[model samples]
Target: MLQMDPMRPLDPALPITPQLTQRLRDRIIRNHLKPGDRISETEIAKVYDVSRQPVREAFIKLADQGLLLIRPQRRTVVSRIAYQDVLDARFLREAIEADIVRLLAKTRDDALIGTLRAQIELQKRVHADDLETFTQLDEQFHRMLADAVGKAGTWSFVEGVKAQMDRVRFLSLFDYPMALLIEQHTQIVDAVEARDLDRAEENARQHLRLMLDYLPGVIAANPSFFDLPEGGLAPSVNTPTLGGEYT
Candidate 1:
């Protein structure tokens, strides 16, 4: 663990606050900072060779984003990833993505279609070796479709939710076949290109549903990663529901 002093000054060259915030956020997302693990501000300040003020500020930002929990006079820890929160995030993503597909189907924007095709080609190129690159292209493919339909805002909202779920997806990749993801994305692109609105929507839904189905296995594999009430990673009897409107 890195340490930092609250009284020291940050480097003159760096944008201390945002840089630290992103680094900490990445650490949390990558499970380097596990759920319930304590974060020491002074330690962070030392690690980054900066003052405690920026570290404290970064902690507050992370807390506001539901990524950290701050306790007065006690240790601050990475927030537990809640089942309800995961479900809600998934629902939001599905709603927005489904809508984006529907609108693209209706509009049939050639430019967007071309971009999607190019993205698919890129995916094929990198799918064999780089999962991170493939994942980024997958995100861009969907965002391109949304942008084509003038629904980029919806994509942005969906992106925020997706980011929350990415850790689970990353874990799932350890157990699931990447080929399946590639195939699914291919099917979605085919449906969209064919102008089959219903098929496209169903494909998108199935993609999300597959992810939801894999959550149990992910939790089981990484019991310590989730912040469940009892039995930690065991499935809950009252499965949380996720769905809502977004402007």
Candidate 2:
């Protein structure tokens, strides 16, 4: 099961369509709803206690993100993992972050250094069972590195394109050892502290490639979560069954 559940009531913060989109997106990325798993609008609408209109809207949105596949006269299924998309995201991220780390290494800001070390400490301290928290902290550490080099904008852009890779990361989390991630993070920090741009760049590249290394085995193990390209179909709005709807 995903650590988070989508069936809960909608958060008050967002509009209905986006709210539903996020819940479904989280589930798909987190592998709570594995790829290739059929998702019935009727069932989801009933489970979330929402009208079919919002759920259908959310379906189109997720399909746009390459997370869901909508087919006419067939069941809606999760999109299969697209390795090409994964590679593209990683490539863009490396191009952006490789420079971020290089620049961050050239400067020696004590406060930033302290922050990097503190984040690494937090990474090490994160319990093995809490993979989700560790993943978030990992993102923060990279964001901090980007901000240090005034490349926050670059990081934002990389994040915007990493939706597919994010799912691969979540899938690979349990399949591979987390210790390697912690160790890699530590090495990256060590290189930064030493002001070694060459080493830092290499470490960043290697760290980003880590997911790619671990993903094949996971995909093989969870073969059902993927599909080849296909056509799409949109459904007309209708009232939902089982009557309750969450945002």
Best by TM-score: 1
Q: Which stretches of candidate 2 lie over 4 Å from their true place?
A: 1-7, 40-42, 49-54, 72-74, 227-247
lDDT string, candidate 2, 143-245, tens digits: 9988888888888778667878898888777765778888888888888889998788778877877766666676677666544234421121211211333
User: Best lDDT goes to which candidate?
Assistant: 2
Estimate the TM-score of every prediction: 0.81, 0.78
Error of 2 at 32 (Å): 0.7
lDDT of 1 by residue, 54-80 (tens): 889999988877888999898898887
- Taking all chains together, the TM-score of candidate 1 against the true structure is 0.81
